[model samples]
Target: MSAGDIILIPNRSDNYIYLLRCAKSGVTAVIDPGDAAPVIDELEKRGWQLDIILNTHHHNDHVGGNAELKEKYGAKIIGPTAEADKIGGLDVTVAEGDTVKVGELEASIYDVPGHTAGHIAFYFPAVSALFSGDSLFALGCGRLFEGTAEQMWHSLIKFRTLPVETRLYCGHEYTLNNARFALTIEPENTALQARVSAIETLRKANRPTIPSTIGEEIDTNPFLRADVPLVGKAMGMSGATAEIVFTEIRHRKDNF
Candidate 1:
């Protein structure tokens, strides 16, 4: 169930669209394509045809190429039904509790509405992979663009329930900036300090810091790890549950 080669096609300066290829199955899916040209280029270069187009939300940057790709390649476009009106050519409009298929592989759908009122994340249980569109990132969660802090908290909590090994594939490349903000909340977290060091190197080399695992994010990402007692205490909120601490950290990041 391991991913074969995850390709990163940099777009829009800092934005990146990732393509996942399964080795044994040759099943391929594009995650949050901001533009059609790069996706078309990559597929043509590999002599591959896109089988599925998985979207996290309906932002232009995320779904800009969805319509083109669907028409050109006949790829199945799967997105949250709550935004079905905006998710162009949506073949399968899903909600929480629904399961979507990519070839023989199945990804469980979660209605993670925080960044947008209808944002959805795809979690492939067999491969331990989660495709979280704009809703979640490496060290941060998306801003409260269309939902409340409480809604975002609930979405984050759902991801917290995933197995520690689940590998998370989010929609953007905002780790470096996110880590800086995280430091303001939990400056002493050793795990975060180490990740900061590693990510700095990755950034310096102009590499993409993505496909972050649920366990790795849980240990280092303040938005997801605020449940740790030490973290809860750092925010000047004693005895608050981890989710509450998590909520506070998100609020701070929003304004930071």
Candidate 2:
């Protein structure tokens, strides 16, 4: 029932590896360990044993270290039920509404299929944190790799329903580029303009612009602002349905 310590590990290019450690129980879990060397090294450095390997999808970059980590630490592997066969060393398959526990921390699983048909997210209500994988990002959303714009929109809507204080930990460090693209969609949005400025400063210092709060994304992320009048007007789709506006924005991003 307590919040955990999260270690953000920058992995292979733009990917991220999150190491969650329960402060109360000293239990540790590796979320999306695309590479095992760093996770293993960090675990040893902290004298923490790996107890869980949690995957949001079966993408190679996300699960590439699954087998090695599981075999090395005897950690139980958990992944999306829809992608169980595709993910290596999976011991448990979960879907929306299911729950996973890491020591005293309990996280709710969410089916956020869009980046991939079986993509999912993990939400730790106790910590007000969401491991959104690649489904949602700062100032942007994942591409419809195996799903449609409508599906991605629905997935985003599901995330938006979480508490505004919920902080999202996305899979990639694409915020700088996403912020630039978002400006094109909502150039007049003051929140977005300010966020872009802040993002530039952070990136210049090589800092991560992640763990963005739902409230911040709601106010600044173009992908999440499709329903706003200004966003719709910019796309020449004023009064358009959220789905339609989202689709247009997604399409434009594909070309952007």
Top of the candidates by TM-score:
2
For every model shown, the clashing-pair count is 1, 0
- In the predicted model 2, the residue pairs found to clash are none
**Tens-digit lDDT string for candidate 2 (1-256):** 4467988999988999999988888888999999899898898888889999999988888899988998899999999999987886789999998999989889999898888999999998877889988999988999898999988888888888889999889999999999999989988889889999999999999999988999999998888888888889987898899999999999999999
Worst 10 residues of 1 by lDDT: 1-10
The number of clashing residue pairs in model 2 is 0
Q: After TM-score superposition, what is the CA distance of residue 200 in candidate 2 from its true location, in Å?
A: 0.3
Residue 46 deviation, candidate 1, in Å?
A: 1.1
TM-score against native, each model? 0.92, 0.97
The most accurate candidate by lDDT is 2
Instruction: Report the C-alpha lDDT of model 1 over 2-103, residue by residue, as the tens digit.
Output: 645567788887777878777667878887888999999999999878888988898999889888888898888888889999877888889999998766
Q: Per-model C-alpha lDDT, please?
A: 0.84, 0.90
Displacement of residue 133 (Cα, Å) in model 2 is: 0.4
Q: In candidate 1, how many Å is residue 202 off?
A: 0.8
